[model samples]
Target: MNSWVNASKFFTGASTVGSIAIPAILKHAGIIGWGALAMELSSFFIFVIAIMCYMSMYDEDGYSSMI
Candidate 1:
């Protein structure tokens, strides 16, 4: 849960043309769009991948508690 939420925040910040997709959607439709949906999904998967990677590395490094 911790890794997921952290990754979520980081991904949303930089996804879709870098850090501004959600704002653009709000200005246009007062809601997010398909592109934004794509961004979220892609970002989420990428983040999950990152988390898995970090988890593996942490284990290798003998770090038990994840940040």
Candidate 2:
């Protein structure tokens, strides 16, 4: 369970980084619009907020699952 959770966290971190980086890469390559970037930024913040909420549902010892 711990391994799976850790792997999920790792992938989430990677995806968060990619969410920032891939947009920039696409814009630089002229494949996306400004509106698309704006949408991505908004969605990323929402994703972060959801992650924070999920984390806060657990206690410091990380034993409680209440999300």
Candidate 3:
């Protein structure tokens, strides 16, 4: 749907800016190495949470349509 497309675009743009800005901000504070580590750990946790959420969406009886 158009709404989904727009939402995806917005998130993609926001994350792109954040990916660039966050590291620069950390570098300015003189801790770029630790910042990169923190970002990686956060990304891993987010991936795990997304997988859990997707798994939870299925009905116990079997697969079900969200729509």
Candidate 4:
């Protein structure tokens, strides 16, 4: 299908281009140093918070359209 093909292309492009930048960003942020574990845990918490915020938009009683 066209959607699958497009998704594959996008994933491939992102994997090739975006993957390299992660290491550079981590190094610059000292995430690869002594505080790596703490930084990783903090990042996980941030991701969870963002997910909670996003999911709150779909709360059943909060918004009729979102439900």
Q: Give the TM-score of candidate 4.
A: 0.43
Decide which is better by TM-score, 1 or 3: 3
Q: Pick the candidate with the highest TM-score.
A: 2
Estimate every model's Cα lDDT from 0 to 1.
Answer: 0.68, 0.89, 0.76, 0.71
**Where does candidate 1 have its weakest 10-residue lDDT segment?**
16-25
State how far residue 62 of model 2 sits from its true place (Å).
11
Q: Rank the candidates by TM-score, best first.
A: 2, 3, 4, 1
Q: Whole-model lDDT, candidate 1? A: 0.68
TM-score of 2: 0.62
C-alpha lDDT of candidate 2 relative to the true structure? 0.89
Candidate number of the best lDDT:
2
- Model 4, position 48, has a per-residue lDDT of 69
| Candidate 4 segments whose C-alpha is farther than 4 A from its true place | 33-67
For model 4, give the 10-residue run with minimal summed lDDT: 15-24
TM-score of each: 0.40, 0.62, 0.44, 0.43
Candidate 2's error at 42, in angstroms?
1.1
Ten-residue stretch with the least lDDT total in model 3: 58-67
Candidate 3 per-residue C-alpha lDDT over 9-61 given as tens digits, one digit per residue, 9 for 90 to 100:
99989986776677668767887687585776577568769989989975676
> Which sections of candidate 1 miss by over 4 Å?
1-30, 60-67
Taking the tens digit of each residue's C-alpha lDDT, what string does model 1 give over 1-67? Answer: 9999999888866664453455555647848666776777677679779988988877643555554
